[model samples]
Target: MPIFGGSSDSEDERTIHHTPKLFTRQQSIHSLFGGGKFADILLWREPKIASTLVIGVSLLWFLMEVVEYNFITLVCHASMTSMLLFFIWSTASDFLNWERPIIPEVVLDESSFKHLARSFHARFNQILSKLLDIACGRDPPLFFLTTISLYILSIIGTCFNFVNLLFIGFVSLLTLPVMYELYEDDVDTVAGKLMRKMRKLYRKVDSNVLSKIPRGTVKSKKHT
Candidate 1:
C-alpha cells in the first residue's frame, strides 16, 4: 500500500510522525509559501485537494486592519519591487550565461487578435443574455423574480459603498466557506438541534398564530 493515502500502517505512521497538523495552520502555510515545485507537486498529485481560501483571505483582511496600510502605497511598492526583481534577474541571467527564457513569447498576430476579440464579444453577449433571462424570470415564478430584482438592486446599492462591497466580499468569498470548513461538525450538530427546536416552534406557531391570521389574496398580473 502507498504511504501517502493508503489504508496501511506506513500511512498511519507517516501521518503521526511527519505531519500531525495536516488540516491545521502549518499545512496551509506550507502549501502557500512553498516554491513553484511544491505547488506544482500539489497541483499534479492532489489536484482536487480542499482549499481554505476563505479563512486565508479573512486572516489577510484582519492583518490589513491591524497594519492600517494604504492600498495605493502597497500597490506602488509591489509594482516597483516586481520591476526591480525582473531587471536584477535579467542581469544575473546574462552574467551567469543562463540562456533560459523567463517570460514566454506571445505571438499575437492579426488573426489571433481577431479570434481573441470574437471570443470576448461572444462571452460578453452570453453573460448579458443570461442576466436578462434571470431578470425577466424566464422560467421562475413572479415571487422569485421579485427576489432577483431586489437582489440586483441591493448589489447596485452596495456598489456605491466601498465598505459594503468589501464586507460582501469578506462574507461571500472568505468568511463563509472558511467558517464552514473549520467548524463543519460543530455547525452540523448545532443546526440539527436548532432544526428540531424550530420544528417544535413552527408547530406551535402554526396552531396558535397562523390559524387565526386571515389570509390575503395575492395580486396577480392580468394576462395580456
Candidate 2:
C-alpha cells in the first residue's frame, strides 16, 4: 500500500483557487498547498488518517532522535524483526497443518513513477525559474523576503541540523494547518492588522530614508 494516499482529482484539478485577500493575496493556507486529498490530510479533514500520520512521525522521531538510531541500523533492525516473524509463522503453520501464509508481491508501477518524476521535474524547474527572477531583481519584495527567510533559516541551522529541522517541519505540517483552518477568521484578522502595521512602517522608511537618496538620470543614446 502507498504510504501517502492518492486523490481522486487529477493533477491539474489539484491546484486550488481562492479569493484574493488583503494579506494572503491569491491564496489561503488551504489553497496554498493545493486543495485535494493531500490538503485534506494536512488540514485534518480526515482526522483518523491525519492522527495516524502524526503518531507514525512521532514514533520515527523518537526512534531516530531519542534512541539515536542511525538510518541503516534502524532499517536492519526492522527487517530482522519482520523476517523473524514471517519465519515463525511459516514454521508454525506447517507443524499445525494450517494454511501457509501468503506474502503479497510488491511492485513499482512504471506509469505512476513516470508521472511523479514529471511532476517533480516541473515543480523543480518552476521554483528555479522564480528564484532566478527574484535574484535578477524582477520582484524586489519577493527578493528581500527570500533573503530574510534564508538568513533566518541559517540562524536556525546553527541550533538544529538538517534531520532535526526536517522533523520539526514535519510536525508543524501535521499541526499548524489544521489549527489555522479551525481559527481562520481570527487568524486572518490578526494577519491583516499585522500587514497594515508593516505597510505603515514601509511607507515611513520610504519617506524618511529611501526617498532622500539621490538618483542618477538615464540618458538616451542616439542611433548612429
Candidate 3:
C-alpha cells in the first residue's frame, strides 16, 4: 500500500517548528495595535462632544472666512484656507474610515488611566514614526519642502496684510481646541484611566509640596 503519511516523525517535527515562524512573522505586522491599545475610546466616551466640537469649529472658521473675505489679505487668506482644508481632510478621513483612531471606552480609574497613558505614548510614537517615514519618502519630498516654504511665505504674507495676520492668529488659537480634543481622546479611555489617576495623584502631591514651602522663600527682586 502507498504511504498515507506525508512525512516521517522528524519531518513532522520540522513542519511544526517552521509553522510557528510563519505565524510569528504574520503576528509582527498584525500586532501593531495589540492588546486593546488602539481601541476607540473617544467614540465610546464622548463621540457627540468630539463630533460637535469638530463640526462647530470647522463651520465657524469657514463662516469667518466667508464673512470677512474682504477684510483678510491674500497671504492670510491662503494660510487660513490651508488650515481649513487640513481640518476638513482630517475630519473626512476619520468619517470615511481611512485613518480613524481606535479609541477604547474604559473607565478612567487611577490604575487604568496609567495604562492608558502608556498606550497613548506608544500610539503617539507609532504615529510619529509613520509621519517621519512619509516625510522622508522619495515621492513626498515636495510635501515637506512646501510645509517649510509655506511658513516662510505666511510670515512674509502677514507682514503686508493685516487680514492675513489675523487669519493666522485665529489658526493659532484653534490649535488649543484641537490639542485638547486629542488629549481627551487619548487619555479618557479605559486603558488610560491609570494615567489620569496618576496625574491627579501627582497634582495632589505637588499641591502638598507647594503648601509646605514658605511664601517668603519666593523672593521678587526689584528692577530699577
Best by lDDT: 2
> For residues 1-224, could you state the per-residue lDDT of candidate 3 as single tens digits?
10111223454445333332211133322243342523222322345655565566556555656555442564587789977877877788877866744456977689877887887898798666655654674223233444666799877885656544655565454444344445633423432333233334544755798467776667899999
Q: Report the alpha-carbon TM-score of model 1 versus the true structure.
A: 0.37
Model 2 ranges with Cα > 4 A deviation: 1-32, 97-99, 114-146
lDDT computed for candidate 2: 0.69
User: How high is the lDDT of residue 11 in model 1?
Assistant: 47
Q: In lDDT terms, how accurate is model 1?
A: 0.51
lDDT of 1 by residue, 70-185 (tens): 66775687689988888887888888986634687977689866766776687588657656764674423322434666799797876656544674565564334445556655
Best candidate (score: TM-score): 2
Candidate 2 lDDT over 107-166, as tens digits, reads 988987787677668768867876887699643444555688899989998999777898
Residue 95 alpha-carbon offset, candidate 3, angstroms: 53
1 or 3, which is superior by lDDT? Answer: 1
Whole-model Cα lDDT of every candidate shown, in order: 0.51, 0.69, 0.49
Relative to the true structure, candidate 3 reaches a TM of: 0.23
